[model samples]
Target: MHEFTPPSGTLLGVGLGPGDPALITLKAADAVARTRVLAVPVKARGAESFARRIVAGRITPAHTVLELVFPMRSDPEVLRPHWQRAAQAILTHLDRGEDVAFLCEGDPFTFGTFIYVFREVARLRPHAPVEVIPGVSAYHAAACRTLTPLAAGDDRLCVLPATYGVEVVETMLERFDTVVLLKVKPVMDALLDMLARTGLTGHAVFVNKVGTDEEAVVTDVASLRGRKLDYLSLMLVRNPARVKEPVLRGCRPKVGA
Candidate 1:
């Protein structure tokens, strides 16, 4: 006779939104409320987990919280092991038919730590059930708070980490009508100088921790130079004078048409 085996539980990647608990989607909240095991990403052992903090009110004693360390480093070699270990930790719970919800600050697929763990989970358990619940991204929240339109008419938009260097940013500014620079802490001064050089200092606005009590919006972006910025900070710039591409007939219709 063949032996029966219990099926593994589902792995959920829940986005809690950008630092604001209210921004969490209904689906994401339901996932967190129902799941017994919660995997949260932390910068170090015993360090605060921003994702966990966003949902602090929802966490009860019945929930089993697991903190997974994901240091603020870009080196893949150093990050791979952590991802593997976090995956294994979550897998341990899944094997027991217990759902594990990995909480993230923003949309799970948008520069969120959940992506790394999701990758490892897929590799380790190829057939495991997985679901990603999307939430409001930081840039979207920043744009909404500042009342800035990310794109209008035929305008183009670009979003990337400011660590790509000022040269790349400058090129992007010339090409795209709107550009959102994430994690500008490392290159704040350089970016300020470049914006001034291009006469775009007035066109940029700095926002950090949008949608939260600690949220900040700076209209004078140049003043941010020499000041330390949080890793959660970002800049939204609009180049209204950017040359628009001519629309070829039959290619695409005009915005109002």
Candidate 2:
């Protein structure tokens, strides 16, 4: 057996992947296996750990799961207080020399709540080591779930939160080579309406709970007219022929050989 090193003082913002625990990257899995404390969100008296559920099968009682309560509202009045509390909890762990693996649902740097702690801890203790482990983002999982290639040779890829309304989506359809609409709960209906009218509906796919038992992939946007959806879902629409740069376009010299 190898010597077990004492926990070094560091913070690892680990990504748990989209939904399936099996999809977690090898590096992320190693981080989880080594995490001393796993911080999770606890809302109200009985809210689910939507993020942790992504890795439920992999976690064990041996791994400490710390719940950091977060308010369900984004009201300016309540937001700061919740963030402060979350930061305090993580800082407490750091002070103990136990590295914290703050698990996030997707890429740690991409919309992960771990930033709140990252900023606060760095501000207070400038020399703390912080490392981010990348995982399979929702868009990548969704695209794979639907078997849709995001980009081709020289094809562009743009991922945007679905908080934008129909108008913004229409604008994206106009300019981008491909679009992955995330956090798509609120505007599913309106966006579907826009895609239908714009004739882009056929190329779009609605993906939910990818890589899990509840995973779903729908080709018809209108089919989801009034259905309930998990917030972890995404919509992928691609048009690969937009800017096909010929690999051999510049193969020959400008002047004849």
Candidate number with greatest TM-score: 1
Tell me the TM-score of model 2: 0.84
Top candidate, metric lDDT: 1
For 12-45, candidate 1 gives per-residue lDDT tens digits of 9998999888899999999999999999999999
Positional deviation of 172 in candidate 2, in angstroms?
1.6
lDDT by residue for model 2 (1-257), tens:
99854443788888878878777889988888888688887665467887778778778888988887766564646766777777777777877788888888878877666777678778776777899898788788787767788877666788887786668877777767799898787888888888878778888889887877888888877898788887778899775434454556666578767
What TM-score, computed on C-alpha atoms, does each candidate reach? 0.94, 0.84
How many Å off is the CA of 254 in candidate 2? 12
